[model samples]
Target chain A: MSTAAATHDDHHDHHHAPTGLKRWLFSTNHKDIGTLYLWFSFAMFLAGGFMAMVIRAELLEPGMQFVDPEFFNQMTTVHGLIMVFGAVMPATVGLANWMIPLMIGAPDMALPRMNNWSFWILPFAFAILIGSVIMSAFGDGNPSAPNFGWTFYAPLSTKYGPDSTDLFILSVHMMGISSIMGAINVVVTVFNMRAPGMTLMKMPLFVWTWLITAFLLIAVIPVLAGAVTMMLTDRHFGTSFFDAAGGGDPVLFQHVFWFFGHPEVYIMILPSFGIVSAIIPAFARKPLFGYASMVYATASIALLSFVVWAHHMFTVGMPLAGTLFFMYMTMLISVPTGVKVFNWVATMWRGSMSFELPMKWAIAFVVLFTCGGLSGLMLAITPVDFQYHDTYFVVAHFHYVLVTGAIFSIFAAAYYWLPKWSGVMPNKTLGELHFWNSLISANLLFFPMHFVGLAGMPRRYADYALQFADYNFWISIGGFWFGLSQLLFLAVAVLCAMKKGEKAAAKPWDGAEGLEWEVPSPAPFHTYDTPPVVK
Target chain B: MSEKQLSVEERNKRTLKKLLIWAVAMFGFAFLMVPFYNVICDITGLNGKTSSTAATDVPEQVVADRTVTVEFITQKGDGISGEFTSETKRVKVHPGEITLVHFYASNPTSTDMITQSIPSVTPGEAARYLHKTQCFCFDQQTLAAGERKDMPMIFYLDPEIPRHINQFTLSYTIFDVTERVAGKNNSVAVN
Candidate 1:
């Protein structure tokens, strides 16, 4: 509309990208880097999912079926680490990288070279992390991989942790560096590179949520780095930062970790809020209800995340007031979260609604994520959490929020944008099949965890009491079914990229809005050489 | 204030610098949390870390009618090659009364050792009201190889301790600081 032909010629000097490996190795293109991130995330997802399979296989009959308990501990530990750091977090960052520039009418991410660096750091970090586990499993003398859980509680991590703990610590430091750089890039890009007339409020929800997420990343990642640094010192340097006899306390570690950790969970979900906000409206044929409130709610949730970290430590002997304060603050999160859920439903209320693949995913996200949020609220009650802490119920709550909430929204975004990215529509039948299978299996996989947890099935154990046998049998079945169903999604995505379906129009969905839709399908390698006027 | 007048590249650099600073500040804040946690826990009487020094303002009169159960527990911390136990597993004392407890510590290894006892009072809200006029934990103890010592700790629980907290445990975790203290003194000697 604004002389795209003219800008095309203007960027001709920068048009020819390097060939093959060099293109990826030295890519400064946001789209290229974003693809790298998504693929990396998928690979990590498979790796982490493989670990889940191992865990399930062992728990199938609760008699130590497939692997020994030590190997089992390694699987659980690395599974959580890979899924959280390696799968969910990067997938969201991938979406942010791909969509933010396109939505904001910017030429590219603000610091493109830095984007490349961020994407590249991840594979090496993960290599170090996984390598440690492999060495522990195979190597002699039981140089065990980090088995102290992903939280890496002290005393266990400091005194009893295996030699591989150092490697785990180093890997975490690298991941922290990568995340901080990525966050900085997002912040700078959104802050400075929007089209001339695109004011803060007028920008897409994806960009807004990402902007806040970047701030959270910038603020909290360093704290995590510090936490690990102290652990490192405690392990090797004779420092007693978490050693009580030497004037430091292990409880100090939890305080520092959950401080970074609570906000980190929000970092995974806030963008899901953005992705769902965009998709629900497009399918509902209605403007998002309470957009301003959505913005306020996201900010309030971020603010509240900082204060409510200690709910994770209710059993750690906090002062009664401290416990109550954390509980109240944690419950307060439900209000803004409810606002978000209500707004999504309200937007769909009385509107001409379509249940496309993306919409189906978004709809499931709303309902299932609310269930996760409700369980989270139950866990927030100090007294209730005393019963549920470290149990399968806690595991159930997170997997629902993370898998259904974050990953489902990711699926919604992928389906919503694949046409634009690949220039062809995906096979709707296959897409729907993938969606339904995933939804049902995911529920089968996670829903019963709440019941099992309430029945006192402690998590992270290779074997459970015989009473949990039936539920676990079903849960394992659900896990395998859910794991296998993702292959269908992979097939759909690959076929779409191969241009198998109908050629997508510039705007694929009739109700979709934003500068992203205004661009031609299969968005050119470079765009917005000259920033388009927003108005 | 004048950023809008700058070129986009320049403005981007400025924001980058600011964000980087914020990141550095947050990193520092993480380490700062260690001290902040201690201060807050000390002030609010949480995390079970009782006072490290003598209390001069303890009340003169003891409330003989109400006897509170003060449980004594001794633990040997990591790397501590020693046996630590309390002579009295539990004691009943009136609020505001001076109470003495004996703890037995022995060095088992074939070398001189220095150890420090760190005390924590659980039902942590009562920590502030439990005052120590003197404690072996106040200074590191030196024990020759196989030497056993009976150390005395004198303390008082203020009548102001919350009525609901009729019982609390005071735990001492003894850490072997022979290497740590020797390291410091060696460094000092070299300096």
Candidate 2:
């Protein structure tokens, strides 16, 4: 591979090198599209985070202080919709686009044009969502967006939802279409485009986890599409799918939504498993213990997701037999999940572990995510769920898994891979400071919620009795601090992106392995144009 | 040529084979969803017709000398003004078969009140095989302050309903709807 040959292999056979706005609008370059996804998701994160702050501010005391109840509902609903669809999912997709090809030694994603379409659809979908919120601000029919919790259960959604609900439905439909397309592209890239010698077992764990996550996304996203479509028809078409007045059951909506929702929870976390698997090894200076078992465990979790959906609906009038069945099925997920956690700890056991910023987040993720998992297991018991069903405990449980588990892993990945992407090592001191503040405050924010929940405080309550006031006060204080701590991450990320940091080597992490390391720092515009021989 | 080049082609073929396996797997998955969906619907009773709607689907009929008494009882813990003291007003019957009852309830409080639970009634207790179907009791209701709304309870005295008859009562209890609060000053109202 001479220099000229390498440049030709990289640059030749390339599509038009569009510049400026057109490059983003009409281009299909994987790296450009990836950057677009990263930036877009970051923007959505800020917007969703703002909504969270509003929610925390409202909950600070109990009674409403700033916004009306209807407006508050919109904030909560839109916040969830945006964070899950706009921020987290796109962030994961961005990482996959940037790293998967390099990791597996492929030139680019297999379906490049489809990739552009997937990214492009997101802006329009979010536009519709934001547009609906703006529309609700006007006093047209109901001056409120969807007040139904993000779950959008029936009867309430069908009978009492605002006119803006129609727009929310359209926005969701668009988002679902975008996600399915993205998932398809990922599946094709991982399955069809790996370089020679990169067998399934030989591929990096990140790629393997992504492959499984893609399948889960593809399988369950359509079910969500179906659920939302039913909601649309029930709202507008007078269809009785969720209306008891016309031969429908409200609880039926929960059955359908959670069927998709439970798998969705895994879709968010499975990739975090991949991120941790990658990071723990590098920091610990060892090969990931039980790599094959980790892959199998992820697959099992994905498969188990479909059966355990009813766990979310245990208190919704299910028979004793059904309740017990769901309880046991839900608990069984821990076996595979526990296998993954054990393997990670074993990989770290006795290894020369260094607490780099990325490693700090990874180590924290394992401990905090296990806390969430244990709580989840506690909720899985039928008799216990009757008490915990709609409490802040459930809220605490999920946020622990999502924010601490999924979001922390994302931060770890950003620190781990920023050097590779930016050609500069991030300021380590600032990175560590961000990690410590986030880790401590995030626990301060969510840890007390478990006790509040156990103390008989129901979730989704605007006001509480005096008994819950103490924990609520602390939780709100923690939330505001957690919210502010994110600014440090944003500052560090911006500084690194602007190249105001130390120059980095191609392989900065000594134990880091994968074809991704074969490229130079700040991986070239076209990586592995002539795909590497994987061996 | 290196042995590796030949093996690359062999591996591509293997990849294609695996892809075929996945495609077949996806196909089997698509095939399974319909039956699985139906199974879930059956298990959850999501597909079952609401009692009211089921009543309407029955063939319209007229009958003679079928006498049935319909009683509406408020659930034990309910404190709504209409629950115990409110007048039953008028019970209009079509005589031979079907009858429709329009019930009105008022909430004296400024805040909204929700009907949390409805008591189930045995058919025989209501009208002795006179089909007692299609009632507002099937679903919970939320009433606003000083709100007087008419809820329809439609039923037919299944000529057979009276034959199996003994007694039946519809009862409801009112509670407060929960509200969701986010951080300070941001609260979403939920029912």
Q: Report lDDT (CA) for all predictions.
A: 0.89, 0.75
Off by over 4 Å in 1: A1-15, B79-82, B184-191
Docking class of 1: medium
Q: Using TM-score as the measure, which candidate wins?
A: 1
Which candidate gets the maximum DockQ versus the true structure?
Answer: 1
Per-residue lDDT over A201-281 for candidate 2, one digit per residue giving the tens place of the 0 to 100 score: 998899999999888877777777777777776665545565433344566678778878998999899989999999999
Clashing pairs in 1: none
Model 1: per-residue Cα lDDT over A7-126, one tens digit each: 546656777878999999999998888888888898898899999999999988968787888888888989999999999999989998999999999888888888999989999999
Tell me candidate 1's TM-score on chain B: 0.91
Q: Can you give the DockQ of every candidate in the order shown? A: 0.51, 0.06
